[model samples]
Structures are given as C-alpha cells and as structure tokens.
Target chain A: MAVIQRSRADKTGIVIRYVVLAVGALLFLLPFYLLVRNGLATEQDITSPSWKLFPSSLQWSNIAELFNNPAVPMLRSLINSLVIAVVQTVGVLVISGLAGYGLARIPFRYANAVFYFIVATLLIPAAVTFVPSFVLVSSLGWVSTLRGLIIPGLFQAFATFLFRQYFLNFPRELEEAAALDGTAYWGTFWRIVVPNSKGFIAAIATITFIGSWNAFLWPLVIAPDQSAWTVQIALSTFLTAQTIDLPQLFIAATIAILPLVVMFVFLQRWIVAGVERSGISE
Target chain B: MSTVTTRLRGRHDRNLWFLIFVGPFVLGLVVFVYIPILWSIWLSFFDAHNTVTPANFVGLGNYVDMLADSAFRSSLITFVVFALFIVPTTFVASLGLALLVNRARFAKTFFRSVFFLPTACSYVVASLIWKLSIFSGVRFGLMNTVLGWFGIEPIAWLSVTQPPWYWLVIVTARMWLQAGFYMILFLAGLQRIAPSLYEAAAIDGATGWKVLRFLTLPQLRATSTAVLLLLLINAFQAFDEFYNLLSSSGQYPPYARPPLVYLYYAALGQGQDFGHGSAGAVILTLLIALVALGQGRFLGLGRRED
Candidate 1:
C-alpha cells in the first residue's frame, strides 16, 4: 500500500513539473508570437480596438515594403550591419586568437605582464571609455565611417582572455611535432593549432558575430549618417519618427532580428557551450 | 660554442614570434583604450566645453560640479535602485528557470532553446516590442487588452511617473532579454555538481526542498557570485533599453535617467560639456570598481576551491 501511494505521488509530481514548464514556455514565447502576428498585420489590424491574435490575412508584402522604404534605408543598413559583423568577427578571431596563443605558449619575458594588462582592461567598464573613445575617433575623422565602427571594437580584452584560457589547455604535443618538422610558431599556429581548434573558434565566432550584429550604442554614436547606419540604428529611427507606421516598424524589427535568430538556431550548441565555458572560466 | 649559439638563436626567434603575434593587439589597445582613458582624465581637469581639446585650466572644478549636480546624484541613485531590483529579480528568475530546465525530462532541448532565443534579439528590438506593443499605452495594447478583461482601465504605462509603471516595462523587457543567458550559466553550475552529493543527501532523509536548500544552493555559490557580479556591471552599463524605451523625439525625460544616459546628454547632447561628463565617467568607474571589490571580497570569490 505504501509503495502504491509513493508511485501515485511521483506521478503527480511529474505531471506538475510538465504543467509548470509548459506554462513558462508559453510566457517566454508569447512576445515572439506577437512580433510575427503584428509584423504580418496591416496598420488597421495593429491599432484596432478589438485585438486579434492573427491578422485577417497575411501581408507578405511587408517584407518587400520594408526593403523598399526610402527614408528608412533598410537595405543599405542591412548590408552595412552584415559587413560590419562579418569583418569584426574575422578581425577579432585573428587578432585575439594570435594574442591568446602567444600569451599561452610563448615563453617570453613580458608574457605575464601583457596578459595581466589585458585582463585589467577587462575590469575597466566600457562606460568609462565611451566619451573619450568617441572623441578620439572623431578626431581621427572616422566618424560616420566603417572604420569608426569596426576598428575600435576589434581589440576585445574579454575575447583575448577567453582565447588564452582556451589555448592554455591546448595540447602541446601537436605543436611540438610541427616544430620538429621545421614549422615555426606562426606556421604551426596556422597549420596545426587552428585546424584543431575549430570548435573553440566557431564558439567565439558565433558570440562575436551576434555581439557585433546587435551592437547599438557605439554604432549609434559613430554612425549617425544615414549611409553608415546599421540595421539597429535604422530600426531605432522608427521609434522617434513623427508618425510610426506600426506594421512597418514591426516588419523592420523582424528583419533585423531574422539573421541572428537564424544564426542562433544553427549554432545554438556552440553558443551554449561557449557561454558555459565563459561563466565557469571566471 | 655552436650549441650555445643555436640556443641563443632559438631564444631570439621565440621572442620575435611573440612580438609578431602580440604586437598588433597591444598597439590597438594602447591607441584605442589606454590613450583615450588618459586623455579623458586630462580633459576632466580642463574646461573642455563643445570641444575635445582642452581649454582653460580648471583643476577639480568639473568634478566638483558633477558631484554637486542634483541630476547626476539622482542618476547614481537611479542605478542603485535599478541594480537592487534587477539583480535580485533576475537572479531568482534565472535560478528558477535553471532549476526547472535542469529537472526537465522531456524535450529539455526545446525548453532551453525557447528560453534562450530572446537573448539573440537586440535590446533595441526588445525595447520597441515592449514600448510599442506589449506595454503600449493604448487599450488595444497586449497588457491593456488583458487588463480590460478584468475591468481595469488602460494605463499610460511609460508616460506616467507617479506609479512608475515604466519600471515594469523596463525591468520586464530586460528580464526577458537576459534571464535566459544567466539560466544557461546556472544550468552549467548545476550540471557540475557531483551526483554523489545528491545521493548522500537523499540517504540523510533530505528530500525535495531540503536537498535544494542545503545541497543545490550551496553548491552554486561560485556561479551565483559570478552571475551577480555580471548583472551588477551590466546594470551600471544600462543604456540601450532605457534610451530606446524612454527617449522620445530625440529628448530623454529627466526621470529614469541612468548615469550613462545623463552623461551622454551632458557631453554629447546639446550641452557638450565634455569636462563634466569625463569627471562623471571617472566617478562612475570608481564606484563600479569599489562595488566589484566589495562583492568579490564579501563572497570570497577567486578562492581556489569550488
């Protein structure tokens, strides 16, 4: 009798767990559902007193309309964001990867000093640097240019720290073999180390790409011109406009989010693993 | 003699490779980060109004003005209130989610993805969705629509400051965006706890809440410390959502202004008071460093054993 009672309680607990998780999942996904529902709705549907979860008919033309909107510069901003994210990702990977590997593997006199310097910079919050960096960039005539957006962000201290931590655990045997075969450190890094570190590289790449893609403040400061505006900047402009076309704004937001969402879906494992590694590494 | 020469050559080559690899990064950091920081400090002592270049020598004047300004002080207070509310709220929400997701048996991956998908969305987009749709001040807005069903009048969520319903909008938006990422961290921490610990607890007749309280919570100390530190820093750096959610027609309302937004206006906006802004920036940085130090010491962070 006691065994049966325990089994019954266990069954009830499992049922309760599923019920709670399902409710939480619904709450989490509701905004995404609303985003799509409103994006495909007409302005009438959006602002109507009587709310409906779905529009009367799907307005697929919202995508085309967003792209063709002249004042918003959606296409240009999208291209700019793409270019910035891609270049920044590649640049960070190469520069931080090299620095990380060097700090980990090279038995140089100042390696510890260099590593500590980079780590110390990580503690200095970006809030302190914002105004001065902008002034410096403006002085260099980089304002409203890709150089302004891309160059300053390339030297990421956190990324370098992460890379160094990753490389510290990297097996020395592979590099030793390459060294024996007359491959210098640079050659060994490119030929042997990098090829084997694909998982780590992919993880960092996903993070850096998402970060660059979603970046708002620095881009907002540096790229005020319409031509240099990233997608995020373009999306924000809708909020401050004299009149907001709710559907167009939602559609533009959808477009801005679609790339990262797609990327996240594809690289979810690496991103999750990368985030886990970062948290534990600290 | 030949062997010694080869050893010397190897050392020389290794040093060269080290410089070759690390040189560009160091140069970039110095040019972009270090130099600008020193320049900011220098500018703080001068009257650098409407220009990046230094003007009259005003030793400590800018710092004094920033400290005396009520608006700047309120901004600091605003951050404290925000951190107090958000840090604990997110900590609980994320820990709750992590506990739930960790215990989930069926479709664990699906639940994890659903919770984490919002992290990929930008703050601007999330703020837009919050301000314009879910928390929109109209009867037809999502929250208002739900409220109508229960006979509550539609509230102008963002504009009104008396009840500060805008806090609900701002905090909820941020919570949705960030809670999942921290959940992932907590999940990792949970996974790292040895299974034998739980078995041992069970053998001691500790079940359910007791096990969680005694075993799980204590085990997650390091993760919790790291998460809180990160959340605190991120709170201090709050700009994108607050700026996007509150500002209208290129003007931010004075209420709900965090230090960064206030400094943005003071320096980069119409005022163009770089000296004052730099002084405020230095003060804020010091405050953050102090908080981090206090938190680290209190928590005994960086002690070797987990």
Candidate 2:
C-alpha cells in the first residue's frame, strides 16, 4: 500500500510538472501565435475595436502585399542581408581560423603576446568604437556598399578565442604525419585541419551568421540606400510615424525572423552549444 | 653545408608562415578595432560634427555638456531602472526554468528548444511582434483581447507612461528573448554537478528545499556569476529593441531612451553632434568596464580553481 501510494504521488508530481511547463510554453509561444494571427488579418479587422482571436477570413495575400510594396524592397533587402551575413561569416571564419591555428599550433616567438592582445580587445566595448568605425567607413567612401557592411565586422575577438581554444585540443599526430610527408603548414591546414575542424567551424559560422543577419545599428547608419539596406533595416522602414500598417508590419516581422527561425529549428543543437560555449569563458 | 642552408631556409619559412597565418587578422584588428577605439576617445575630447575629424580641441567640454543635458541624464536613469528590473527577473526566471527542465522526465530536448527558439529571434523582429501585434492599443489586440475576457476595459499598453506600463512591453520582450539562453547556461551548469552529491544528500534525508539550497544553488555559483555579468553587459548594450519599437522615424521619446539611443540621437539624429556622442560612448564604456571589474574582483571571476 505504501509503495502504491508513493507511485501515485510520483505520478501526480509528473502531472504537476508538465502542467506548469505547458503554461510556460504557452507564454513563450503566445507572441508568435499573435504575430501569425494578426499578420493575416485585414487592416480593418485588426483596427476594429472588438476583441477577437482569429480573423473571419485569412488574408494569406498579405505576404505578397508586403513583398509587392515598393518602399520596403523586401526581396532586394533579403539579398543584401544574405550577402552581408554570408560574406561576414566566411570572412570571420577564415581570418579568425587562421589566427587561431597560428596561435595554437605555430611556435612563433611573440605568439603569446599577440594572443593576449587579441583577447584584451574583447574587453573593449563595441560602443567605444561605434562612431569612429562609422566615420572611418564613411571616409573611405565605402558606406552604402556591401564592403562597408562586411569588412569592418569580419574579425571577431570572441570567435578567434573560441577557435584557439578548440584548436588547442586538436590532435597533433595528423598534422605531424602531414609534416613528415613534407606537407607545409598552409598545405596541412587547407587539406587536413580544415576538413577535420568542420564541427567547430559550423558552430562559429552559425553564431556569426545569426549576429550578422540581425545587425541593425551599423547597417542602419551605413546602408542609407534602399538597395543596400538589410532585412532588419528594411523592416524598420515600416515603423514610420505617418501610418502604421499593422498587417504589413507584422508580415514584415514574420519574414524578418523566418530565416532565423528555420535555421534555429534545423541547427538548434549546434547553436545552443555554440551560445553556451561563447558564454562559458566569460 | 647543405644542413646549415636547410636550417636557414626553415627559419625563413617559419617567419613567412607566421606572417601568412597571423598578419591579416592582426592588421584588420589594428586598423578597424584599435584605431577606431583610440579615434573615438580622441573625438570625445573635441568638438566634432558630421565628419570624422574634430574641428576644435575642447577638452572636457563635450563631457560637461553631456552631463548637463537633461535628456542624457534621464537616459542614464532609464538604463539603471531597466537594468534593475531585467537583471534579477531574468536570473530568477531562467534559474526556475532550468531547475524545472532539469527534473523533467520527457521531451527534454523539445522543452529546451521551445524555450531557446526566441534567443535566435532578432530584437528588431521581436520588438515589432510585441509592439504591433501583442501590445497594440487596439481593443482587438492580443493583450487587450485577454483583458476583455476578464471583463476589464482595454488598456493602451504602449502609451500612458505616468506609471510607465510601457515597461511591460520592453521588459517582457527582452525577457522572452533572453531568458532561455541563460536557462541553457544554467542547465549546462546543472549538468556539470555530480549526481553523487545529490545521491549523498538524499541518503542523508535531505529533500525538497534542503537539497536545492545545499547542493544545487551552491554548485551553480560560477555559472550564476557568469550569467549575471553577461546580463549586465547586455543590459548596457540595449539599443536595437528600444530604438526599433519606441523610436519614431529614428527620433525617440525622452521617457524610453537609454544611453546608446541618446548618444545615437546626439550623433546621428537632427542635431548631429558627433563629439557629444563620442563622449557619451566613452562614458558608457567606462561605466561598463567599472561594473565588470567590480564584479570580477568581488565575484572572483578570475580566481584560479584551487
């Protein structure tokens, strides 16, 4: 009888835990649900002064309307965002990867000092360089171009540190065997190291991609031209004071987050581990 | 003779390899990161506008002006208030979530992903979702609809700041986006704790609150400290959501502006005062550095694991 009672108590505990979790999950999901619900609602339906959960009719065409709107340039901005995010991710990976490998594998005389300097730069707030970086980019006449968006952000101190830490654990035998076969440092890195370090590279790449895709302030100031504006900057254009199109704005937001949502759903394991790794040091 | 020549060639090759491997990143860091930081500091001391070059050398004038400006002063207050509200709320919420998820028996990965999905959502997008869809002043909106169900009158969530209910929007949006990430950090910390400790505690008849207090919380000290520090830094970097949701056409209301938004307006908005912006940036950086340093010193962020 006592064992049965204990099992019953355990069942109740499990039920209570799930009940609490279900409520919390609803709280987390409510915003996304609201976004989709109103995103397909008519402007009149949305603005009407009556409480309703779902629209009488689903306006699936709102997505088309958002893309068709000339002021937002949704497609072009998406292309711009894609270019910026991809280029910056690739650039940081190459730059930081090379530096990490050099610091970890190469026995250069001043490697320790150089690594220290790079890590110290991570302490300096991005705000400290915010305006001057803008000015420098502008002075070079690179503003409103992909070069401006992609170049200044190509090197990441945190990502470099992450790479260095990972590389420190990399097995030396493979590289040594390559060296014994007369493979140079560059050749070994390109042929063996790069192929072997794909997991770390993917983790770093995902983190960098999300950051680049979501970047707002720098792109806002630099990419003044509609053609050069990223998806984030383009989404902000819908928020002007003149008129607030609720459906259009929601649609834009949905579109803005859709790629990230998809990426998260697909690569969530790496993304979560990457975020934890990034915070583990600091 | 050939061995000596080969040794010399090896030295030459090593030097070449070092430059090839490390030179690009170093040069990029020097020109883009270090140079801009120094230039920003220099610009803070002078009167600059529109251009990168400071037109006049005015030592401490911009700093004095920034301190005197009521807008900038209030922004500092606003940041403190926001940070105070967000830091503990997030810490507790994430810890609670982590503890609950840690004890969950089923669909652990599913629960983890559901909570963490928002961390990947961009602030700009999340802000719009809150501002436009959920918290919109319309009676038919999400929050208002829920209120209607309780027979309460519709509330204009984004407006009416005498009591500053708009903080609801800002606070909830940020918490939803960030709490899961911290929860994952806590979960990672939780997983690191040895099961033996918990088993030993249960053997001694410690259960419920005692186990949590003695075994769990103490074990998570390092992770908790790191989470708190990261939260503090991120709180200071508050710009995107505030700017996107609250700012109208790149101009912000005085009530909701944080230091970064205030500095953004001073530098980029109609006034275009780059000197003041740079000064404010420098001040903000110093404040963050001081906080981080204090936290590190007191919390032993750098203490060796003896």
Candidate 3:
C-alpha cells in the first residue's frame, strides 16, 4: 500500500515538471509569435499598433507589396543570396574537405605544421582585415559582383580545422584496403570519405549558409548597386526614425530568417554533435 | 642507373599527388587570405589612392592623427558600453531560455524553433523590423503603442542622444538578434549537465532557484566564457545593424556617431582617406586583441585541462 502511494506521488511530480517546462517554453516562443503576427498585418495595421496578439486580418498584400517595391528589387536580392550561399558552400566544402582528408589520411612531413598555421588564423578577427580587404577587392576589380563576396569567403580557417578533426575520427582500415586493392587514393576519397562524411558536410553547410546570409560588412562594401545587394541588404528598407513599415518589414525578416530556422530544426542533432567536435582537440 | 631513376620518379609522383589533394585550400588561402593580410599591412603605411600612381610613405602620421581624433575615442567608448550591457544581458537571457526549452514537454522542437527564429534572422532584416514595427515615435510604433497603454507619452527612441535612449535602441536590437544563438549554445551545455545532479539537488531540500544557481551555472562555466568572449568581440564588431539602423544616407556620420561609423565617415563616407581608415582599423584591432587575450587568460586557455 505504501509503494502504491509513492508511485502516485512520483507521477504527480512528473506532471509538475512538465507544467514548469511549458510556461518556460512559452516565454521563449513569445517574440517569434509577435514577429509572425506583425508580419501578416497590413500597412494600416502597422500604424495602429494595438496589442493584438494575433493579426485581425491576414493582409497578404504585404508580401506582394514588398515584391513590388521598386527601390528594393526583391527577386534579384533573393537570387543573389541563394547563389552566393550555395556556391560558397560548395567551394568551401570541397576545399576544406580535401585539405581535411590530406591531413587526416596522408602521411606527409610538415602536415601538422601546416594545419596549425591555418588554425592560428582563426583567432585573427575578420574586422581587422575589413578595410584592407575592401581595397584589395577593388584592386582585383571584384568590387560589384557576387563573385567578390563568394570568392573571399570560399575557404575558412576554422572550416578546414573542423573537417580535419572530423576526418581524423574516421577509420583508416578502409583507406588501407583501398590502397591494397590497387585503387588510387583520389578514387578512395571520392567513393568512401566523401560519401561517409555527410553529417559533417551538413553541419558545415548549415554554418556556411547562415553565415553567408547574415554577412554584412563585406557585402555592404562590395555590392556596388541595389540590384546586386543580398537579401540581408534589401531587408534594411525599414529605416525611418519617426515612421516605419512595421508589418512588411517584419514579414520580410521572418521570411529571410526562415531557411536557417528550418535547416536547424531538421538537423538539430548534427549541429549539437558538430559543436561538441569543434576545437576540442586544441 | 634505371633503378635509381625509377625510384626518383616514384617519389616525385607521390609528392605531386599529395599537393593535388591539398591544392584547393592551399591555393585559395594564398590567393585570398595570405596576400590580403600582407597587402593590408603594407597599405597601412602608404597613402593609397584610387588612381594607379606611385604610393608615398606617410610614416606614423596616420596613427598619430587617429590618437588625436575625438571621434575615434568616442567610438571606442561606445563599443565598450555596448559590450558591457550586451554580454551579460544576452548570456543570462539565453541561459534562462535554454533552461526553459530543456524542460519543455509538448512540441519541444516547435518551441526551440520559435526561440531560435530571431537568431537566424539577417541583422539588416531584423533591424528593419525593429525600425518599422517597434520604435516608431508617431505613437503608432508597436513599442510606443504598448507604452501608451501605461500613459507614457511617445518619445524619440533613437534620435535623441539625451539620456542616450538612442543607445538603448541599439542595445535592444542587439539583444533580440543575439539571444537565440546563445540559447542553442547553452542548450548544448545543458545537455552535458548530468540529470543526477538535478535529482540530487531536489532531494537535498534545495529550492528551484538555488538548484539553478548551484547546478546550472557551475556546469555552464566553459560555455559562459565562450558566450562572453564571442559577445564582447561581436558587440565591438557591430557594423550591419548599426549601419542599417543609423545610415539612411550612406554618406554622413550615422546616428550619434559611434567610432566605426565615424571612421567610416572619414574613410569611405567623405574624406576618402584610406590612411585614416588604416589607422582606425589598426587601433580597433589592437583593442580587440588586448581584450580577447585578457579573456583567454581569465578562461585559463593556456592551462591543460584533464
């Protein structure tokens, strides 16, 4: 009878634990709900800011109106952001992956020295290089194109270091067996290492995409005209101290932020795993 | 002689293949990173102009002028103040959010996504939302509208430098954009905390608040340092949101004239003085390095952990 009573108490404690958790989760979710409701409202709704937790009317015109804004050029901006993020991710993955493989799989003198040198650059803040990089970008005649932005960020010091660590954890027996089978090392890399490292690749892809999307300093400096501006640059349209387009701007931001949020949601475990693996060896 | 030649050929082939394997990264770094850094250091000493002309050495004049400049000094102060508020506020808020999300039962993923949405936001986009939706002083902006319910009059949010309400706008902007990213980091740290510790605390007659203080904070120490240093560095590196929020005209000193903004005004916005820009860049670099190194020491980065 006492055991039965203790079990009931334990179940009650579990229910109480959930209640505490639910309230806390609500606090975390409030701002995002505020953003979504605000985004769907009309221009008039933006001006008459009542404390309506949900939108009174689903004024879907804001999205089209945003598309219609001449000064903004929405479609072009989306293309630019997508192309830059995609292309940069591809280039970064390929380069960093190859470098990682070489350090991990290859037996070469001075390999450790080279790896450390690349990793050391991670501590040097990007801001330090901002001014000079701008001048250098212009000197190379890459000032106005997506190419300028894409090329500069194509390989990161940390990404190379990250890939190296991931590759080191892979088993070497497969590579040895491939070598003994009279297979070339490059073929083995393509068939085995590249296919096997999808999780790390996804992790890098998420980091790079979000990073490219949010990148401000270089994009602001390099993109010569409004036509070439990334989505991030286009989203800066709500800039009045006295009066501003609240609903439209919020909607645009929510849309802009959606891709990364979705990616993170689907691959949450990979990211958690990635964070654990990164820089711990140093 | 043929045997020796074959051996030499074999060694050459292996070295060549090794280079090809690592070529992409090595080549990219040399072209993009190494060259840029060396050129940046070189250009810091030269009076560079747009025209392809002979660059003249300006010696230490640029650095000298930067030290004398009031705007440079103000910008540094502005950044320091920003870091002071943002680092602690974001860290605590994220930890709180992580604890909240960690305990959630129903639709936990959905709740995590909602919390993380703002962080994924592009800074310029987020800043635009803040500008239009929230602080519009016409009594119609969301924040002002909410304040109206409390009988508070609509006041200038970012324009007036008095009591630095303008500064407050920047801080809030940073806080909203940053909170979610750190929450994820804290969540990762929280996952590492043994469940047994929480159970032990509950059994020891510790209150919820005490359990949090004793259990969570100690466990999250490394993550706390990471968050603090990252926030401190990022706060000083504030460019996008600050620029988009303040610089509508792209030519003037944006808003109340932060140091980077002021430096941008001098270098790119008006005088087109790359020399002055270099000076500003060097000083900011030195300041950031000093702080980062100090934090590294505080974190005991050099000491090997067991």
The top-ranked prediction according to TM-score is: 1
The interface root-mean-square deviation of each model, in the order shown, is 3.4, 3.5, 4.8
Deviation of model 3 at A280, angstroms: 6.5
lDDT (Cα, 0-100) at A40 in candidate 2: 92
- Per residue, candidate 2 scores C-alpha lDDT tens digits across B86-187 of 999999999999988999988888888888888878888888888877887777667888888899987888766554678888988999999999999999
Q: Taking the tens digit of each residue's C-alpha lDDT, what string does model 2 give over A195-265?
A: 99887788888889999999988898888898799998887877645577888888777877888899999
Candidate 3 colliding pairs:
B75-B259
Query: RMSD for each model, in Å, please?
Result: 2.4, 2.7, 4.3
Name the regions of candidate 1 deviating beyond 4 angstroms.
Answer: B1-9, B297-306
lDDT of 2: 0.83
DockQ of 1: 0.59
Compute the lDDT of residue A212 as modeled in candidate 1.
94
lDDT pick, better of 1 and 2: 1
Please state the Cα-based DockQ of model 2 relative to the true two-chain complex. Answer: 0.54
| Displacement of the residue B4 alpha carbon in candidate 3, Å | 17
Deviating ranges (above 4 Å) for candidate 3: A1-39, A49-56, A237-251, A271-282, B1-14, B49-54, B105-107, B195-215, B251-259, B297-306
**TM-scores of the models, in the order given:** 0.97, 0.94, 0.87
Worst 10 residues of 3 chain B by lDDT: B297-306
Residues A1-282, candidate 1: write the lDDT tens digits: 988998899889889988888998998898888888889999999989988988998999988888787777989999999999999999999999999898888889977788778776766787667898988999999999999999999999888878887788889899888767766777789999999999999989998899999999899888889999999998887786658988888988988899988977889999998878666684
What ranking emerges by DockQ with the best candidate at the front?
A: 1, 2, 3
